[model samples]
Target: MLVSHQQNSILKHESLLVKFLTKYLSRVDSDIYFAKSSRCVTHSFTKTATVLSMANDGTLDALPVVGLAHNDDKKIPRKRVYAWAFWDWATQPFNTVLITFVWVPSFLTSTFFLDPDVVGTAGEEVALGQLAANLGAGITIAGLLIAFLAPVLGQQADRTQRQKLQLMIFTGLLVLTQLGLSFVQPGQEWFWVGVGLIAIGSVFNEIAGVNYNALLVSVSNSKTVGKVSGLGWGFGYLGGIIALATVVGLILSGVLQGDSALTFQLVALGCTIWTVFFVIPIFVSVPEPKTRQVGEKLGLWGSYVELGRSVKRLYKEARPTFWFLLASAVYRDGLSAVFVFGAVIAGIVFGFGFTDLVIFGIALNVVAGISTIIAGRLDDRFGPKNVILVAVFGLVACTTAVFVLVDLGTPMFWAVGLILAAFVGPAQAASRSFLARVTPAGREGEVFGLYATTGRAAGWMASLLWAVFIQLAGNQAIYGLLGIALVLLVGGVMLLFVKAPARSPR
Candidate 1:
């Protein structure tokens, strides 16, 4: 009797094992599974084991799991979305205040004393040539350094989970550097100080931007990326406008009364404050992305080897990305040149004053903000590439009109300038969206770093070319601007040939 009972017990155990295995396998083979505890049904093979174990009170959960995989949701929540967008708002004050409006123009006018309009002499020519050389040399060195190091740093950040920390360090550097601009007194020495700060700040900005961009994947789903990106840009434009407005108010009010040099010094302080305060949101709200461990230890040489391999892979797998980069590099460089010289041309050539320049800047920002917001809808409708083409054409036309109607004074000036500003927002917003379309998953940071690098790579060249044309032509800033128009036209034509990738999500 005892032997018979033992045999029955063994049979019962075998029966339960067989039942569990069969049920698990069947669940894996089907598309749907029923979980009794959660009282919900999931339609995926990968979740079968979890459903089955839950249905059976978790006893069979330890069975060797097979065919398990994870599915990613391509959507983002609304709150985090806004927080992510605000990062751009925080950083753009640096671009507007230090680089564009106050510091650069002041450096050219005050430190160098290069008259915006040099009449009937080689004086203008020599000054422009020297300015071009200095700008070119600075950007070239910065671009080369970024190209070599950005990707490696991105890779290391991915491996080490240090992206947020890197962002903090770089952001702090940018803020400190801008604040340091306060001490740049009116002298030739100030020129060097200005250039050095610009160069270093630019480097840190690019580095931080790369890390910040990499975090996009973690912040939002693929569907919301475009909208999220547009929001960031919109916020950036708004920030720039606010900062510019404040500076203009202070200067115009005579509250900061002093020489032009002292007025500019106050403007620099405003920019520094903007940089420091705006960065607080990013530091507080944005979280670092989770990083996976690198399988093998890499020495410095190994890192270089890996980077070289990545470059090779980039060329092979991302041919479209390369072409886009090439086109973007040329056109973006031209755009930089246009803005860099816009205020100077208006003041010196068109006889615009501080009030006029401030108003123009305000108009540019307002138009650009509206255009960027509209571009999001257009991007979803006709695709980012189509919007980019339209923007590029608009850029070309406006640039040409600027030169053609050079004699129109303020009316035609504001007309053409506003039109150009309209394109600026869409072009920039669409360019970023187009890049987002082509960039591979998991590499947005390194790729955006390249984007920033490419934009800056030939920046000096464009400025140099413009300066040379103006210098050689003598009192023909219009002719120099025409050269810029040609670049935009050519870039637009080239972009037409390249096919844009299929649109996905927002």
Candidate 2:
């Protein structure tokens, strides 16, 4: 009976204190008067009840333990967000030129890695199988390495408050790595050299993206993050389109010298120049987010321990973050293989010539860029989960068509493949937005680093399946493309199991 009376008195006092703060501090520092502490709210509430009963001047001073309501939803500048989005545009060539449409399959697999002497005698099929296997192996190795490195590096970046610094250093290295590709001539020896440089560039790109994605929270709040993420992803696809067109124009006009090793080399150099020109905006404008409480300084090994603890904590307090990471990781790998093998399928299975490949790339990027931009608005309105669910389903359906209608030739690839392209960018953008929506405030770098780690951990799925299917199906590129589709199909099914928050947290 006495305890119950004391509880009532505490509740009455807390109500009176809240009313007083609401009236007096509303205009002064309402948020400061009652901000949500980083600690457990239940624990903070218990502490606040004791202070309320005391009702002393010092007790009022301790009010921050039970924050009235800190302004977590403050609007950031538009220019700062655009500056951040430019980073995606700046780096798109790494995907468009090096990994996907232009260089990987068109030139590297056909001209550089595929030896004419060996291919002529052993048959193109046998040579292509070897080339595909080697390409898959190199990429798989790089991804495995990334899985090991990304989380530790991200945690350290969070601790050191060096997201932007790390982004700049690694991104500069990525540009340098791309520029080095300009020297890769058409020869067997140069093939592995090209692969090595590309793999390194891939690593740098992933690491830099960890920081860039983390920075999203700093530039936009919950209401605008989805659109902003979509803006960045859309810019990337659009930039890829322009870059592809430029290369095609240069090659066709004799400016790049068609069929010469110099043509592809010039394309690589152009991507390098484009990266240099555009990445400047992000470095100039988006300032680094300030670091929060740096709990006991951990060494490299200790950081992993810290990461494990964070994961455990996240699972308990933020189940959405943990589940979404697993779900997105699966689908994202399939999305990656779409671009990774898109041109490969066109060049090898569909018999697209260099011009056809370049033109096809232009079309693909245009649809992807435009759809991603539209999806951004939809994401803000209908929620990122809905946007992703729709896009991923479209991808799965397109994948089935590409397989079932394999004999239809170029038209089928153009139609069904573009359908696949339309969804890839939206799903990718929404996944990033979804992560931003669930990320705990002040832990952006660590959470996003885990984001990179989770994705890279499963990165081998598409490439492995690509290699496996081709090997089993008589070294056919069509069979290899089916492997990627299977991955997407599986990922989409896995996503259905994860119960994503139906809407972005308002």
Off by over 4 Å in 1: 1-75, 107-140, 258-263, 290-304, 464-475
* Residue 322 displacement in candidate 1 (angstroms): 2.5
- C-alpha TM-scores of all predictions: 0.76, 0.80
Per-residue alpha-carbon lDDT of model 2 for 1-506, expressed as tens digits?
01123345433543563354235323423222222224232123334345444656542322221111112334355557668877887898888777776777677778457666776664877887787778767877888777777887877777777889989999999999989988898888888988888888888999899989978766655455566688788778877776676666656766666567777787788788778877987899887775354454578889888889989977765655688788888888888877767767777788888678778878888899878877877886787878898988788778768878998988888989888888988999999888876665456678888988898888878888988998998887777767777777777777776655333223
- At residue 9, give the lDDT of candidate 1: 46
Q: Going through the candidates in order, what is the number of backbone clashes in each?
A: 0, 5
Q: What is the lDDT of residue 99 in candidate 2?
A: 75
Q: What is the TM-score (0 to 1) of candidate 1? A: 0.76
Candidate 1 per-residue C-alpha lDDT over 93-141 given as tens digits, one digit per residue, 9 for 90 to 100:
6788667766575454343445436634667667666765686577567
TM-score for candidate 2, please give it: 0.80
Model 1, C-alpha of 467: deviation from truth (Å): 4.3
**Local distance difference test, each candidate:** 0.63, 0.72
